[model samples]
Target chain A: MAVYTEVTDEALAEFLTHYNIGSMVAFRGIAEGVENSNYALKTTQGDFILTLYEKRVDPADLPWFLGLMEHLAAHGLSCPLPVRARDGKNLNPLAGKIAAITTFLPGVWPRRVLVEHCEPLGAALAKLHLTGAGFAPTRANALAPDAWAELLAKSAPRADSVQPGLGGELAQMLHGIVANWPRNLPTGHIHADLFPDNVFFLDGEISGLIDFYFACTDIYAYDIAICLNAWCFEKDFSFNVTKSRALLRGYMAHRALSEAETAALPVLAQGAAMRFLLTRLYDWLNTPPGAMVTPKDPLDYYRRLRFHNAAQGPAAYGL
Target chain B: MAVYTEVTDEALAEFLTHYNIGSMVAFRGIAEGVENSNYALKTTQGDFILTLYEKRVDPADLPWFLGLMEHLAAHGLSCPLPVRARDGKNLNPLAGKIAAITTFLPGVWPRRVLVEHCEPLGAALAKLHLTGAGFAPTRANALAPDAWAELLAKSAPRADSVQPGLGGELAQMLHGIVANWPRNLPTGHIHADLFPDNVFFLDGEISGLIDFYFACTDIYAYDIAICLNAWCFEKDFSFNVTKSRALLRGYMAHRALSEAETAALPVLAQGAAMRFLLTRLYDWLNTPPGAMVTPKDPLDYYRRLRFHNAAQGPAAYGL
Candidate 1:
């Protein structure tokens, strides 16, 4: 639900002159990405998405994101490929912001996570990791384990206000996650934020992946941990072992996990939980009252963090 | 910029069971009308718009609104026609609200109104009035003259807080508008809110009309008055007489205005300006600070009211 900048008719007509896509038939602002403004565009040629990167996205990182999409798409993955303008450049300026057009992928993001969705999600993610090996560009995860302490510092003082004793509990969890963080396993570009909304499906099969703004170079198994935390949890914050088994089975079918990687799932999952909990807690405590975006309840992630912290080993994750 | 209700994948799949339109290929929540939850849907058959009527729209009027759209499109007006389901009904339940699907209308709404857009807008609006004569069901404009006092009463207390002397000025203007409200003018169905966003254009020609939730039976000339205020005003709030003249000329090429209606243009325009001003002022004063939807500036309409109030006759409107 973001359209921070309005493109005037004159500006749009002029902007389209730089692209070879046919004349604009219909265009509309769409509620696609939160950090950037997205528009669903239709033309005499085909359907596409026009994205105007807002201030939250660094212009320096945009080319990497677009290039990753192109690389994944070129290797037979179904994803949005950036449409180059007549000048052979993917990034251009529109309405005082960097803008790009991507070929529209056909599917709807599953609003509710289903057991049937997890296996395909696992396979798609593993496929992404496997295909990303040849891409030369490397971007460190901005929200990596090293960065969690800085986020915790900003929110720890007030975290207790969200839940009784949350501040001290978060401090303990952060220290544990940082000390035990996995160092040496598979590494590649991982979609760090592959939540249900970022994965699209058609006919109960994975059709495409989107929102690569959060994709970065990290341990491949850490990507699995993120998906486990995102997809294998029930609404009650309880882990579903059946879904976990299905997800891991799907991932293993594509690329077998190393013994070290398999053994490190618990700590990686906890770290993943900590990353989201800290951010959500920060947003919950920091978002001004009556703000447009109501922050997610931090307590949900807090409960998941406690579960992951208590787990004995990979067996607890049904690996 | 709204998606007030989140439709689950299961609900959408079940809901589509009632429609013969091909299997869903893509669906995305779009920022179209502010009053309803709209999703742009692409299916194997073609593109369409799914609208979930929010609480602002009365459920009883849903059929009438759809009927009006059906009537208009049946007579070749190039508007979205309601897509009936296999059960031969247009309105159905989805996500706990009445929802309907309409054939998608292609073309972009002009972000910046231009003089070239004015003539076609006027001609299309006149055609709508002429074609609307056979619609059997009649809906009175809910925001008619009688409703202003109640709205003003709710907002008047904080009115002066928005401006130095707006409260008293609003009261006086309401009195004059209501006292001299036109009695008899060629009345028919009018798209009460025919602003730039409701009209779509492609290839420099009007393509479609939309948001029929605001359509109602009212003075046909009053619709003209509303358009004169909407399409003929420059961004700085100055009246553009050249655009006004072009609009009136295009309108007259379709249907001639009665002498009484012609003479009443100034007062009608003033009253039209008052209607929008009072509503916008009410929203401005009543909406809580930092709410999701930022209220439009009431002063813009206040300035338009002043211009229309000071006009001498239809000549001032470029007759």
Candidate 2:
């Protein structure tokens, strides 16, 4: 639901002159992507997505994101391929923001996570990790264990306003995560924010994955940890062992997990939960009074953090 | 930018069981209509628009609206035709809201209203009036003259808060409009809200007309009067007589304006301006705090009302 910048007809027509995608037939601002403005564009050539990167996205890091998508797509991963203009550059300037066009992938993101969805998602996640090994660029995870202390500090003061004693619980959790965070095990490009909305399913299979803004170089098993939190949790904040087993089985079928990786899954899962909780808490306390997007409930992640705190080992995750 | 109701994947799949439009391939919530939840839906058959009518729209009038689009599209107007399901129903229930699918209309809405755009808009508008004559169902314009008094009364208290002496000025204007509003001037179905966004263009020609939620039975000349205010105003709020003349000329090429309708243009235009001003003023004053949608500036229409106030006759409109 973001269209922060309005692209005038004159500006768009001039911009399209550099593209060989034929004349524009239809263009619409789509309610996709929180950090950038996205438009579903149709032309005489075909359908595409025109994204205007808002200030939230760093222009310097755009090439890495675009390059990652291009690389993965070229290696047979299902993702949006950046459509280069006649100038052979995928990135350009439009409406005072960096803009690019990408081929439209066909699929609807599953609104309700199903047992059937977890297997395809797991396989896709493993394949993404495998294919991304050859990509040259390296971007450090911004919300890694090292950043949690700073985030928790920023969010601590007013977090109790959301719920009494919430800030104190988060501080305690952050202490534990920083102490036991995994190190030096299977590093590569991981979709750090592979939430259900980012994975598209078609004909009962994962057709495409999108929104790589949170993607960076991290332990491959940490990606699995993120998914265990995102996809294996029910609405009641209860962990579904069946879904977790399906997801893990699918991942293992593609690439076997090392013993060290398996041993660290609990801590990695706790760290992943901490990362989201801290950010959500920060956003809950600091979102502008009238911002369009509602801050996600931090308490959801807090409940998951509590679950991780009580878990014994990888057996708790049904791994 | 509305997706008020979230349609689950299961609900959508079950809903699609009734349609012959093939298996769902893609669905993205479109940031288009303000009063409804719209999604750009792709299927194995073709592309279409899925509209979920929000509570704001009267459910009883759904037939009239959908029927009118079907009627106009069947008669060769390039509007979206409602896609009927296997049960021969165009409207159904989805996510506890009334939903319908329509063939996607192709073309982009002009962001900058140009003189070249006005002529085609005028011709298309006239054609719409002509073609709408044979439609069976009739809907009275809900925002007509009778509704103005209530709207102004609702907005009058906070009017001066927006601008000094604005309340007094609006009261005076309302008096004049009520006294001189025309009666019985070639009544027919009219697109009462044919602003620039509702008209789409491609290849220097008008391709389609859309958003029939505001369509109703009203004076045909009043629709022209609405267009004159909508398409003939420059950004600086000055009347563009050249564009007005082009629009009127293109309109007359299709259907001649009778003397009575011509004589009533000034008051009709003033009423049109007042209609928008009062509604915008109401919204400006009544918008809830932290509402997602921003209230449009009422002063824009206040300026247009002032322009209509000084006009002596139809000649002032460059007719």
Candidate 3:
């Protein structure tokens, strides 16, 4: 759903001279990443993805994202390694934006979530958390509890427009969740938005993880919570316990979960749901109609929040 | 610009089973063709383009388009060849739409037209005409002069909203062009819409021509007229006689234009301009303001039409 920038062939040929990837064989704008312009580039050597960071992406965070991808790949995780130019730099200027190339990974992301996809997704998420421990760079989660109040204040007036009593329900839930938020959980780098589209698979196995733009430092279980909300829900927003059970089983198989983390699963899941719900609510109300990218329906996450709010404990997650 | 239909990984794997191409290595929806869903597909064997024909295309016309492509490629034209499945069929079904895979051509389309591009483009157009003689399919041009009057009638109501007196000017021009439209000098299969985006260049040479969905039976000179309007005008809509001269010279070097075709250049070019102007006017009036694909400005073609209308025969094009 992207390709916001147009690169002239002349400019592209000039850009490729900085890299060692050889002359361009073919290049095309790909509808993959949302926040940037992405081109599927082929050269004499191999295939690569060329990305031009749009205004939505903070240029200051680019180095961190690229560095983290390198770190994860170095730690035996499958991910795109940023290709550095002959000048020994990954980032360069092109088409009035910061651009970079990364080695292309071969796989297709699952468009339809299946029950079998949940377990491998959980294992990959756990592996990412474990591998990221050695990387020292720390970025605070931008959409944590502290940002919820302002987000609510901005979208509260129109939240009920989407569904009756939605604003009030959100307000009450926010108050309770903030008051009971967990502490002392294991903290590490987490992919806060590990949706199905960001993980690619080949032959029913996870081939690579991508889109590290949303990677940040957060509680480990909270990352798992995001996955449960993203990967274990049906199209109708109903929580599938079987998929959830397999997911947690996969995670525990990689690294054992602490008793404290297990006890906090319900609140953590609810918090994860609220995090997405607030952002989606803001985007829902603010995005202009007929924009290229449609905003996700916030009420889907509302249903998820309700499911987590009523859960008894980790057993409800089939832990 | 496209990717209207979402293909699932499981569905795509099943679709590829019919093809001899090895298992999928990588697949991504590319923002290339406007009229269909295009994916840059890579297999264990080679690169290819998977196109799912959308609603805008008529299903009955598929064979003719594929046949013309095959005909052109068999005659040594550097265009994409439709890759047949194991069943010896080029077209199949995927994602609820008719799909086909074509051998991926290696080159990038020029974003900005250069003087050197015009000559090779002209030579290629002539070669396409010569090679297409064996193609017996007789699909009429949907945007020919016969259809211009009705198109004008549809957009006449709001044409003035784009500019005062624009509607009357268009009506008058359409009448004159249709009335004075020349009889056939030489008729053959023509790539009726050979725009810069449809022609790919590599190392200052025209490596391949593509997007043959608009190919049809038409006068050869009319195709040249379309090229003149497409590649010989500056961004400001001023006619570049230098490029036009190179184009015609290069074309004549391949297939010499008859005296009648040369004499009819002004009217044919004006007719080409009118055809595009009417379509743009209709789309300009109909498309929503914030739609994903912005309609082109009708006035650009209007200016070209005026230039062609005022020309002193082929000499104005530096022939």
Return the candidate ranking by DockQ, descending.
2, 3, 1
lDDT of 3 by residue, A1-319 (tens): 7888899999999999999999998888997777788999999999999999998778899998899999999889999899999999999999999999998998999999888888998899899999999999998888898889889999999999999999999999999998988999999999998998899999989999988888899899999999999998888888899999989988888978999999999999999999999988998898775565657789899999999999999988887
Interface CA RMSD, all predictions: 2.5, 1.8, 2.2
TM-score of model 2, chain A?
0.97
Per-candidate TM-scores read: 0.95, 0.95, 0.95
Expressed as tens digits, the lDDT of each residue in B252-285 for candidate 3 is 8899999999999999999999988988888888
Q: Candidate 2 lDDT, tens digit per residue, B44-110?
A: 8989999999877899989999999999999999998999999999999999999999999888888
Instruction: Tell me the tens digit of each residue's lDDT in model 2 across A146-203.
Output: 8888888898888889899888887887888888878779899999999998999888
Task: Please list all clashing residue pairs in model 2, or write none if there are none.
Answer: none
lDDT scores in order = 0.90, 0.89, 0.91
